[model samples]
Target: MVDQASRMQPTKSTSPTPLKVVAATDLLARVQRLRDSVARRAYEIFESQGRTFGRDLENWLQAESEFLHPVHVDVAESDDGLTVRAEVPGFRGENLMVGVEARRLTIAGKREAEEERRNEKTIYREPCSDQILRVIELPAEVVAGKAAATLRDGVLELKMPKAAPAKKIIPIGPNMA
Candidate 1:
């Protein structure tokens, strides 16, 4: 039997991981790969359904659901900028990447399956990898270079400042012929 005081000891604490900022080009490439994979899965699904012609959308959606986990997100707008919050459970910051373009934001994460070490006989085991990709379109243009992101308690938050509108200047001088 364990003593009460020993059993109540606190566990070790670890620092939070920082999110990785990815270049727009790299992010786009990753997106393209994921799209291709989904397309293949969708085609397989279509073929499995006896070459159905009218269920293209349904097949694509089903394939997406199987390959990617759903990410719940919310966007809030203020007078000066926008804030985005996304729920990404079971993902550490180091496993996540963020990309920001003019009016688009992309978040991607992948968790590799852990190796199993059995000290004793095991009855059953199942290992799998998880991947997530989510892209959001902003209502207003943002200053992509000024975007900041943080992850805490399985939630990712981004603060982006709005871009200033371009102003056209007119010459107020006499025209010379």
Candidate 2:
């Protein structure tokens, strides 16, 4: 018979895989596509509303909601490092990922829904998912390895130390005509 301790021993993986890095150009293209989709949806909404004057902001907000679930974020700079705060309710620390690569900061989160009775009749349902993704180019370089992130009270905060800015010396040219 196998001993209890031996049977309860935990197993470890033999190998680990590295993470993939997304190109900046690809990120930019995805953002552009989202923007275009929002614009088109907003225009359609305006037309559906009988082309009423004013309410541009409302239309845009509606369009954005349709295009993507919004994740409010605030970025601040300090002497120590840059801090990013994001409001992501319905998500726990395990559901979020914050990383910096190629001078770009990426924030991704997802909240999975529990299984429910599928055969039951449903009255009204609003599609919802606690997923959020945003990629932003940092104004200054950052130390990715030293970065830290914390999630509290449904808010996610990240602190990253900034790297020295690149310097360039240009020669003075003769006065232009």
Candidate 3:
């Protein structure tokens, strides 16, 4: 039997961070992009496999791994800005490239290939390289120049301040009667 004081309790933080939210439209677009890329790659894989049947799932999984596997991100919106967190394991902060243009955010990275040599003799060659390039269309307009990003523990977090909505003024027609 465990007493109340003996039971471990979860630590509470003072700061309140809102839950991440991805817009439906953005999610749909991302899915569509993934589907298109995956389809194309899968078709290529199928052709490479001599147009074999009963391997639809295998082809799709391979295509997904090749084309749509990296830079998975979760986007959240707040009154002040948009927050984007991306999972980028096995990558260093210096290897990542984050950019914003118009209403789009792009995340890209590459892993260098490795080669093994024995006594200056080429024995084995392995290409375990990977590249990730993902462009996300923001739900709301943001000031690209003011964006900030940080990479820690294989995760990238970005904050982009929302752009002020455009304003227009109409001339009064002398108080139309």
Across residues 60-134, which tens digit of lDDT does each residue of candidate 2 receive?
877786457767889898876888888888889888888797478877776777656688997876655555666
How many Å off is the CA of 177 in candidate 1?
Answer: 19
lDDT string for model 3 (24-103, tens) is 99999999988998998789779978999999997787668757465688999999899999998877877789999758
Full-model lDDT for every candidate: 0.88, 0.81, 0.84
TM-score: the better of candidates 1 and 2 = 1
Question: Candidate 1: minimum summed lDDT over ten consecutive residues — where?
Answer: 61-70
Instruction: Score candidate 2 by lDDT.
Output: 0.81
- Number of the top-ranking candidate, with lDDT as the measure: 1
The best-first sequence of candidates by lDDT reads 1, 3, 2
Task: Name the regions of candidate 3 deviating beyond 4 angstroms.
Answer: 1-66, 113-122, 171-177
Best by TM-score: 1
Point out the worst 10-residue segment of candidate 2 by lDDT: 125-134
When 2 and 3 are scored with TM-score, the better candidate is 3
Instruction: Report the Cα lDDT for residue 119, model 2.
Output: 83
Backbone clashes in candidate 3 total: 0
RMSD of each: 16.9, 20.4, 11.7
Provide TM-scores for the models: 0.58, 0.51, 0.57
